[model samples]
Target: MESTMTGNASGKKKEIHVGLCGAGIGGVFAAIAIARAGAKVTVLEAADHLGEIGAGIQMTPNVARLLRKYGVDKVIGDNLVRFEELNLRRKDGTPVGYTQTSRIEGALDQPWWLVHRHHLHQGLVTVARQHGCNLMIGSRVVEIDYLESNEVTVRTEAGETHVFDLLIGSDGINSVVRRTLFPAVKPRPPTTNCAYRAIVPYEQIRHDPIASTLIQKLTMEVWMSEKAYIISYPISAGTDFNMVLSHHRPHPVSTVEDISMADLRAEYATFDPRIQRIVDMIPNAQRWPLLVTGPLPSWSSPRGNVVLMGDAAHSMTNHMAQGAATSMEDGAFLSVVLREVLAARIALPDAIRLYERERMPKAFRKQQVSFLNGAIWQLPEGEAQRARDRAMEPELRGEPLLRSPNLYGDPATVLEVYGYDAEAHAERALQEWYNGQDWRKDEGTGIEAPVAEKVMNWFLPEKEKFVSKI
Candidate 1:
């Protein structure tokens, strides 16, 4: 294998030697982005087979644009469902929060899609290969050492050590690279929450006429309760419906090893009959314990040549369905920063610092939203949950006091999340940095930690009635 970019050097085109630690969605997209910027990319994966573990996953417009920007959007769009609307309802089936899917695409000029995790994974792998990335499966990076020269040497389980100018860890939340960098960062305990997921054939869905129609629609519908939240969407050309039922209770069997239909039914026994009926058809359901992590002390190694991405850097709750979307966004923004660094001839450490400085604040803001969503959805119904729901109803109905800038804001609401243009910011930041300016630290002018908190509280206010009711 060629070890350096000089082996196949052509005139004029700048070449970067990049090594990626995981071949998952984030890793593959990073490869695509770096390759588009004229880099020689190599990906290493621990899994012998290149299949994802989950059932279906959602990709919002933010992720959609990243894939489109990297030329992999068509692969995802060709095999996924484009949700036209997103409906949030109470357990009793009363509508709560509503938003047109058009707003997402309109804000970002890209569409949202839902696909099987395996399908999207395969699509990303295909795109990565087409873009000239060398994907080496079953070669897990067992250790990483940042040399004095600002290069990285990664040692794999197969007893191979590869040195590269830069190393990226996209190895999910259980990142080997992250653990090596910071052994003290323990995985957060199960948020007292777990989800049971399965995909049932669309034909079987028709058995329940009312739900079957809803299941076939081009919408992502979620029903919220203090006990749990139910999310269902159409995937596989409406031939199947993806379902995830989450709750805030411990299970008799926490491991995915022994999960069966009976175990699933017992966990979901208190849900609506409609949801229970759907779970009954699923002979086997996978159990996934939810986890949380705080902002890292540092997202990049002290060497600056090593950095984390995706779940390794920040793993948020799935309440907002932003985990995968945010990972893709990370890849997009990280790529732009790397390109800027290269153009400006910035040192590797400074570039990594710049990337983390620009990415962390936005990622943290989303993480806060995800945490609040989990709290609201998992609150047990009593006087507290009931009063909390009542407070949210007004906000859902367009109360002026509750209206502000958020991920779900309507027209006239500034697009902070979806409307962001990382490519543009990156280009400007690069030009400024090259001209000996410190634009990285000042990327988000007037956007501070307190400002983000205040903005978030506008949509989600503290419910004194909830505390008093309890």
Candidate 2:
């Protein structure tokens, strides 16, 4: 296969062709960013349609600023609900502490938005297409072959073969690209937590004396309790309310299954009466067990050309509400790094290395933070639980909440997570990597090394057995 380089109107740099394995949020966002950076991108989606499931996503300022830069925020303008605060409360409806979204926006220079997943997905699709991204639906990537020419050939289930300079695995947790890269690693097992999700029309609850209060104002509410937590907020311009209830269970069930309202109510029987009333208003709901994977030793393939992002790289629970936000950040970071590679300012291997080096640590950190947040939310009834409640009491009294620092820090640290700019981070990493380093030699060698040898050398210095397989 021969490499092809197309020039833009200004004829500044060669356009890099990027093959994306999934057309979900991350893939589509990456497509837009790459196209905006003057590259050609094609997204392969397995589904026949380009839409997201029934759910709501919280977009922090970090993600919002990137979306604005990509023009996605304009496409989704006013169709989203902006919240002033995130209200935390106990299961009994006692107010804990609150994070002022307004304050965060003032600090970050962008608003916090809650939007329907479908709305966000549709907006991204629109903006990506506007940037001339080729979105091929019903095309599932079945296999990927890294060629000796420093190119990649992707074979879809439809038997069509396409070659590109880079291949990205943005296909969520069950990513085919991820499986192909690490066949020894098994599918992630289901976590002990199961979630019930539903969307109720605002009109349905607007007239109810108790339920109407939930919709009278716009705020993201979280109710924490022993072994369970509930999150509810308005989405789709407050025409509907999206709610998710997660609880610990003894055994794992199917990821998604039809669940009865009675079952949901029984599970949250100990919750506040107001919460129960809201649960009763759910016309339909589905339960799914959360699934997670062990952090991969590396997100990139041994060859370094093929890599993972978003949930494909690090699947975490929703406790932090950063699932979609972090995926957007991944796309932003990858696009910036690839722009440097395509411009010939950096070698592909070094670029990929820098991308992984900057992203892996942060992604893993967020994953651990998300896990810890979930644990805090679901602490069982005990002395530990009482202490947590006591710590939250100050917040209830409108005082600055004092939290005992542990493995994970305070809410301020979470605010820092929201303040991160992925694009800036990637650019800085690139600068640092090129500061007196001779990356040109690796570039001259076509960036090819034995996959097994590289993995063994990097991960297990003493293990020479894996090198024999290469």
Best by TM-score: 2
Residue 346's lDDT in candidate 2: 62
User: Residue 387, candidate 1: how far off, in angstroms?
Assistant: 4.4
Best by lDDT: 2
Give candidate 2 misplaced runs (Cα > 4 Å): 1-12, 147-149, 187-190, 401-411, 437-470
Error of 1 at 318 (Å): 0.9
Screening candidate 2 with a backbone cut-off below 3 angstroms (N, C-alpha, C), the clashing residue pairs are: none
In model 1, which runs have C-alpha deviations exceeding 4 angstroms? 1-14, 251-257, 387-414, 431-470
lDDT against true structure, model 1: 0.70
Residue pairs with colliding backbones in model 1 are none
lDDT tens digits, residues 1-470, model 1? 11111211222334468898888888888888877776678998998977788788877666776767666667766677787776766665666666677755764567778888888888898898998999998898887888566778888999998988888988887888788788788556345677777888878878786556566567776777776888888887667778888766554333444466786777656665666677777867666766655588788777778888888888877777777777777777667766644554555566677677677887888788777766766667687666655655654665633342223544432256555555654564554555455432224453332234334423344562112110
lDDT of 2 by residue, 90-175 (tens): 88878765666676677566777889999999999999999999999999888788846578899888999999888999998788
Residue 349 of model 1, lDDT score: 67
Query: What lDDT would each prediction earn against the true structure?
Result: 0.70, 0.76
TM-score, cand. 1 vs. native: 0.83
